[model samples]
Target chain A: MLVRGVTGMARVVPETRDEILAAAARRFAVSGYRGTSLQDIAGEVGCSKAAVLYHFANKDAILTELMAPAIGMLQALDERIAAHSGAAAQRVAGEGFVDLAVRFRREIALLRGEFPELLQQPAFAHIQRISERLIEALAGHPERPAARIAALVVLAGISEACGEFADIPDEELRPALLALVRRALEPVD
Target chain B: MLVRGVTGMARVVPETRDEILAAAARRFAVSGYRGTSLQDIAGEVGCSKAAVLYHFANKDAILTELMAPAIGMLQALDERIAAHSGAAAQRVAGEGFVDLAVRFRREIALLRGEFPELLQQPAFAHIQRISERLIEALAGHPERPAARIAALVVLAGISEACGEFADIPDEELRPALLALVRRALEPVD
Candidate 1:
């Protein structure tokens, strides 16, 4: 939150909650989710454990909040894809997925590392359902084994690309990634 | 080992060494490398812990041996790609990778689930070197960021597809994978 400084000039106020989440994300990424603790997050944020706890109930709460935006975007993409059918649906799903994956690379890295079990948790279960819908939309013809493989490839390929080309600027990588997904989801003869 | 039975018939003898390795892989896959123990391996194989230790010195030895085949094949792919230049190299690399990924879905699952830290060890170091080589081979023109992204996507995408479409038979998934990769590596305007 912003507030006036001592001299009456506008200044940015510290948002301890956002800072805690940022620290937690960094800690969780460097060390596995299981390896990181509230203390570690607090230490990174230059705060006490009590301060960290003050912002969030626990580690899961912090992670869930950090992930909330990504999950929301994914759900939005699923909803968008639902309106289209066949090839149009596949294109929409591909574009939306690439955008989602690019914007949430850290979340993808977090999901890929140390947290498959988390997806089974009630909080993350809905993500699995959204993913299934996105996959179905991307597949075009869901019954064909070939189409199924293509859709799966696009879903996973983009996330992989995000990590692999982490050094590349998103603006440069985005088109390449989008093109790859478009091709990967294309119907095979 | 085959031996003569009491009735003078050739009987296939139980190879305790192979049995121990098989049990260790299964245990490691399901419970993770760190999560499993020699006692678990021995119990699964219906052998004593000493017997398990006698065959393999430790858990790392078992993992090293289990991953030996995959690392070997990946090196072979890298070597095959070295002989060709440009698109031919990309084609050979893609086909070789698809074959390798299809044949080692369980190994990929094992890598994905646990033991990523295991990759940095001396025993698994060669896999990393080979993977970089394979990535270069897959990318026809490494200087272009787009080409780089495409190659990285296929490398990780195939592994992801292997797990995502695990239920699909190799004969069915393999050709579809190959086609999708072929398209992914194609030049984009």
Candidate 2:
């Protein structure tokens, strides 16, 4: 009976860990860092608080895992956008924005939600650096504030629209959105 | 001694609340929602956990309050954006985008930091709704997906630049950013 209990307890650990992460994502997504607790996460997983600690050190670790996929996806999207260079750069950038907008709406929303704290994290600093590099590569100058601002505006607006404007279908908004971005990238008079 | 303690305690409530919020903002801004704690916050404010809770019912309430000001500012910016109409709409929208870009940079960075959950709160939802309304009012139609998309692209690009490209000063960025936004709103082939 002791051996069986040990085996069963071992099986419970991984499942409990997954459960804790899932629960933590929901709570953190809604309540943020300060609002959640190890106790609350343990309760959701139907495990002891110590069980949660065994799998994950703390809530921060849980949040880190949850957002890892999102960060990866964003970087991938950046790569895809960068792939659209040369004469087709403009069109490719537009399509990339549309693709990202349509596919990653939920992730974008989560990012927007968690963004304030995310910005301060060392993990996110690399993403910012990557973004700046991408902007420089695309605009041909790290110091082109106008181009940088224009790119940011387009990206943020798309994120905002995709996450919030569910009533406006993607197809309807995609073309106009691209046109706007292209215009924004144009040299100032 | 009891009377003196009671008076001291009473005097501490409002100040403690403000202190907690301020500290929470700093922590949340760095560590994010899942990374911070009421205990950490209390330590910052030089108070007990119970005292922190005495001011805020929970972490959610604290985050909600921190985000409240950002939401209000966005709303006010939207109102200001809406106040300009007609042929001047494009130019006014450009200017508004620049102003909001400057204002929202820190808060947006903070949003990206710890209190990401605030994005789901009604406060953010309200900002989204108001922004949509402002877009509609400026474009004079919800069906103008093209124009709406254009506006979104321009505004979003500018906002993104402000946060990710802080190395660039506002004086150089602001006017250039305005021009980029104006260009985005212009007719495209």
Candidate 3:
């Protein structure tokens, strides 16, 4: 019985970490990284700040953890698009980018509002590289002005949609965002 | 000749204020509002921090003065659009928004990257109201979810385009951005 109880407690540990992360994400999204403090997150999570620290080294660690999954997904999308070229690459990258944007809406909100400082951090250095690579893939690796501008518009559209339409359900927002992105990328006459 | 020299000296005062604002805008864009210091702005302008203070009351004052013209332009656009309806309003607001986005590219860059904290200050309170009114005008005052989403996407696209395509000359970028905004607002079907 004691062994079973120990196993049960082990399962709860990871759940607690996730709960802490969720609380941190919400706080950071609403108040911003510089504006939010550990005490605020702890209050939201209903735990002591020290207890929050026990699960995460610090607030930056919490931010890093919150974004790690999205970063990994972006990196994977980058790899997936690397195998394709031309319009095929653009289509692949676009679909994957939309998926990631909708799935990680909160993180994208934090990023859109606070990217300069966040991206400048050494821990997020890879995110900048991955984003540039993703942009290149979406632009079909073209250095042309039109293609570059189109990629940027589509990207900005996706990020802003996620933040601005918070009241809309993701199921509704996903197709709307993808359609808008497609329109933005349509050939200019 | 003495009077002319005095007039020239008077002109220099406003010029110095302009120089200080330009330097602060650049620093805020690169490092964000929280990360930048008054001393840094002074350094960039090759003046004492005290000289910077002489022109503006504080860092927040510098930010407010930098954004005041853009906010005023938005208010004027809002009033102009108030008299129009449906597609006409969207068109007018879109053109004005694009022009402001391009003309105030540096300010838009700072707003896009650091808006949440910057907008919360009391001095910038009017900016938030003006932005909402502008968005309403852009959306043709529709409370519908799709229209609201489209307006946001277009606004975000324009703002992001101005920041991302800094190398593209404004003359070339203006038409490209306006075209993209129009395309993004087209019916999804």
Tens digit of lDDT per residue, candidate 1, span B1-189? 223355755535458898888888787666567668889998988878998888887779988888778878888888898899887887788899989988887777566534345667788777777888888878888888788778887777677555455577889878988888888886533
lDDT of each: 0.76, 0.60, 0.75
**Native A-B interface contacts kept, per candidate:** 0.67, 0.80, 0.62
Judged by TM-score relative to the true structure, which candidate is superior, 1 or 2?
A: 1
- Give the interface RMSD values of the models in order: 2.4, 3.7, 1.8
Q: Model 3 reaches what TM-score against the true structure?
A: 0.85
Give the C-alpha miss distance for residue B14 in model 1, angstroms: 4.0
Model 3 lDDT tens row, A34-81? 778999988887778898899888788988888888888988998898
- The 10-residue segment with the lowest total lDDT in model 3 chain A: A1-10
Runs off by more than 4 Å, candidate 3? A1-16, A46-48, A187-189, B1-18, B46-48, B140-143, B187-189
Error of 1 at A142 (Å): 1.2
User: Candidate 2 — which residues are off by over 4 angstroms?
Assistant: A1-133, A164-173, A186-189, B1-21, B31-35, B54-84, B88-94, B113-129, B138-141, B154-169, B186-189
* Error in Å for residue A97 of model 1: 0.5
Candidate 3: the clashing residue pairs are: none
- Mind sharing the TM-score for model 2? 0.59
TM-score, per-candidate, Cα-based: 0.83, 0.59, 0.85
